[model samples]
Target: MKAIVVVGASLAGLRGAEALRQQGFDGTLTMIGAEPHLPYDRPPLSKEVLRGTWEPEQASLVRGDNIDKLELDLRLGRRATSLDTGRRRVELDDGSAVSYDGLLIATGATPRRLPGTDGMEGVHTLRTLDDCLAIRAGLERGPRVAVVGAGFIGAEVAATCRQRGLDVTMIEMLPVPLEPAVGADVGEALAAVHRDEGVDLRLGVGVDAIEGDGRVEAVRLSDGSRVEADLVVVGVGVAPETGWLEGSGVKVDDGVACDARCATSVPGVVAAGDVASWHNRTFDETMRVEHWSNAAEQARAATSTLLAGDGGGDPFESVPFFWSDQYDLKIQSAGRLAGADASRIVSGSLETRRFLKLYGRGGRLVGALAVNEPRRLMVMRRQIRALPDFDEAVAAASDDGSA
Candidate 1:
């Protein structure tokens, strides 16, 4: 039987394997992962898992029985050190090689660790299950938590700490949470939510250093203020986990460059999830999204293209979609708005903390961000697929207009 090898036991990897099986490929499947744990849902790690609402083990997406039934050669705790595209083989860190008829590069990313704080006892990041366990344990002890980034991860961590009754403070170099992703207006709305929840939200403040001898005791800011905390969770962001493929001939820009079908430059090699960067249809540009839905959608598209056999479509086309639950609000965004030349407020009053913002470039609808209104996002999706005029839609979104 032909062997199809998937690297990185992340969301995309697991979903891709399932899609391949669903496509009726009865080949030998091997999954390689650096972490020893089974594939788990990461979006919950920073949210429910840290809040004590979910167990750490409950975060896993795939179970042992499922893998056994699939008859997948599960290689847990094995890291792919390098890839030999010419030979169609993957080199494992254990000095072993796995030959493959087809390969999928779903090796996700690692949290960018803070420098000089690696060996420190109390510094943490919430990328993997182990990291969540460590942070959850620290929260159980009611340690003061200082989060170094105000992005989604940082905000969720702060909210989780507050839910556990631990003193929490969030620090960000920007003036608001998710300023770059959603723009200043929407970001400030999120910051207000954090403040109303009793979080010490610090904006435009840089971390001078993490202060402590052997353990974290305080976080010093660039403005000379210090927040005392026994625990620190750094959510600065993540870089693509492409170190293993450094000399592997797979093109890596911001991430592994893939065509619309998620195929890499090397034949028979594909990439998906946060590790893969491809042309975004709505934005008409290349992007690498780290959201959970993106991983699943990309994997499904990649799998279909793979099974179709030879000279498939140019690329996968899916508008970006991601959601976050914090302080009773369900925030959702569809399509990419970074290149928006203009935007207008739509539906619900912005001052009331419930609204949808429409973005467009050259008068064409590009994206929409909604706060506490998920139904509107669903409508935005259909309108986005048609590439409607942003000006009319922005005016109509408030009038209960159809997508």
Candidate 2:
């Protein structure tokens, strides 16, 4: 391919562009980013940046002389309006079209917003650098904060606000936070952690509306309860950015549907990151991972698939991994945790707030979660890739003196 275009110049897009060059594809590389800035690390936006421990520059993905060496036609602040498979062209919002011999769709996702919260001064979503900055500025006011969602992002923001000694009330519709992803037992344990840190945890409740005249003044719960707030941060989740590919014939379901090799329905076009939903051969399941690690790893794999031409590359098989930092705990997980048949804490205890829990599905050891148990979590992660029997894995863990 003589020319290539990479949409969504964030972590996945930046890494994919770099991989193309590393694989000896020295073509006219054009990177289109909706954001006005260069690709920057996102995980820190919720932690250090929101807490004022790190400046905005610290989140830069490529620093010093690194980005200069990529030789990229970096088009920032420009969104890809649509894609045309017939002409191999991408239409941008700036009234320009770029033809590509190969295309990398890394459009990622946009955060879900609560209705009637738009144009409200104190309502915020943490998805971008600007979003984080606005919330951080609100934090300076020491506002009474109501976080609507118990997901990782919401939890982190609440933890950050608490660290700053702000009154934080976290609302979740589910009785246990992250129960669907990590199981009820583990979710309860996490809830205890937040409570211990002085977070006003409101479970089994949904936000009915944001009550305010012009700025967010309070959150009305579904149970007819009101959480008086000066600022509201919504962390409900995100939806994949696939609207531009509707008529592009890329086969988008929850994301851009790709095969095991990361090749999309259209030849010469592949996807990665939050926007790409590909079949993972290792797990024997189709998934779209929104973690930072998956974005980087899958980008390289998707780029390889693109370079190898149609039906030429090896399958992109990987164990999903993600980490979340809240208070004094670093929660980490590997493989698929959701929809597991069973889970057992093989190390430590929940009362101690440090443990390693193994998850099994269909008689196979499929996932592992760790609370301050990184070493054991990685070992379990590797074992998960081998697809060992759940009972045998648990026995091995006991024999190895994990508990």
Candidate 3:
């Protein structure tokens, strides 16, 4: 390939570009990004950056000198408006077209917003650096913060707000936060941690609307209750940013549909990160992971597939892993936990807020969740790669001396 074009200019995009260079692809590499700033770490936007523990620059993914070494034809503040698969060209919002011998789509995702909340002051979504700064600025007012969605982002934001001595109210439509991912038992234990730290967690309730004359004054719940707040952070979830690929003939089911090797429907094109919904040979399932780890790992896999000519590369069968920090707790999980049918607490106890739980599906170990027990979690993570029998894995966990 003579030239390669990478969209997104995000963590995945940056990683993909680096992989292309490391894999000996000394081609004309063009990276087009909608944001003006270079790629930076996003995981800190909700924790270190929002909590004022780390400055914005501290979250940068690469140094200026190192990025210069990549020799990227970096086009910042330029959005890819559309793709033409036939001509292998990408049309930018600036009305310019860039043709490529290979393409990597790592556009990632956009956080979902509440209805009628757009243009409203004090209503924010934590996705970009500017979004984090805006929310941080609002935090200085010591406002009563209402965090919608009890997911990782919402939980982290609430925890950070409470640490700053601010009144925080977190609302979730489900009865327990993260129930779908880690099961109800584990999710409730996590919920207890938030309550212990004085977070007003309103579960099994949906946001009716954001009530205010102009600025966000309160959030009305579906159960006829109101959480009065000066600021609101919507973290309901995110949708993959695939609108630009609508008529490109590249399949998009939840994200850019790809094979196990990260090869998309269109030849010479591949996708990674939150924007790619690919088959995982490990779990024999199709998934799109939005976690920080998956973004970096999948980018390299996607790049390998792009260089290997579609089906020539090895399958990207990775065991997904993610971590989140909330208050005094450090939560980590590996493998697929969404469709788990059985789960068992293998180490520690939920009452103590420290444990390693194993999730199983179809009598095989499929996932693991750890709260404070990093060592045991990694052991389970390795065991999960072989898809051990559920009961035997549980039995092994009991005999493991390291755990």
TM-score per candidate, chains pooled: 0.96, 0.98, 0.98
Clashing residue pairs in all predictions, respectively, total 3, 0, 0
The alpha-carbon lDDT assigned to residue 133 of candidate 3 equals: 97
Question: How many clashing residue pairs are found in candidate 3?
Answer: 0
For residue 182, model 1's alpha carbon misses the true position, in angstroms, by 1.2
TM-score preference between candidates 1 and 3, better one? 3
lDDT per residue as tens, model 3, 85-127: 9999999998999999999999999999999999999999999
What C-alpha lDDT, on a 0 to 100 scale, does residue 350 get in candidate 2? 88
TM-score order, best first, reads: 2, 3, 1
- Give the per-residue lDDT digits (tens) of candidate 2, residues 1-403: 8999999999999999999999999989999999998899999999999999999999999878777888999999999999999999999998999999999999999999999999999999999999999999999998999999999999999999999999999999999999999999989999999999999999999989999999888999999999999999999999999999988889998999999999999988999999999999998899999999999999999999999987888899999999999998999999999999988888788888788889999999999999998888888888899989998788777635643
For each candidate, the alpha-carbon lDDT, in order, equals: 0.86, 0.93, 0.93
Give residue 130's lDDT in candidate 3 (0 to 100).
98
lDDT by residue (1-403, candidate 1, tens digit) is 3889999888999999998888788988999999998889998888888787888778878676776666789899999999998898999999999999888889888899888998899999889888988888888887888999998888888887887887889999997778778888888888988888899988999999999999999999999999999999999999999999989999999999987778888877888999999877656678999989999889878777666656674468888888887877788888877777888777786578788888888888988988888888988976887678877888678656643
Clashing pairs in 3: none
Runs in model 2 deviating more than 4 A are 399-403
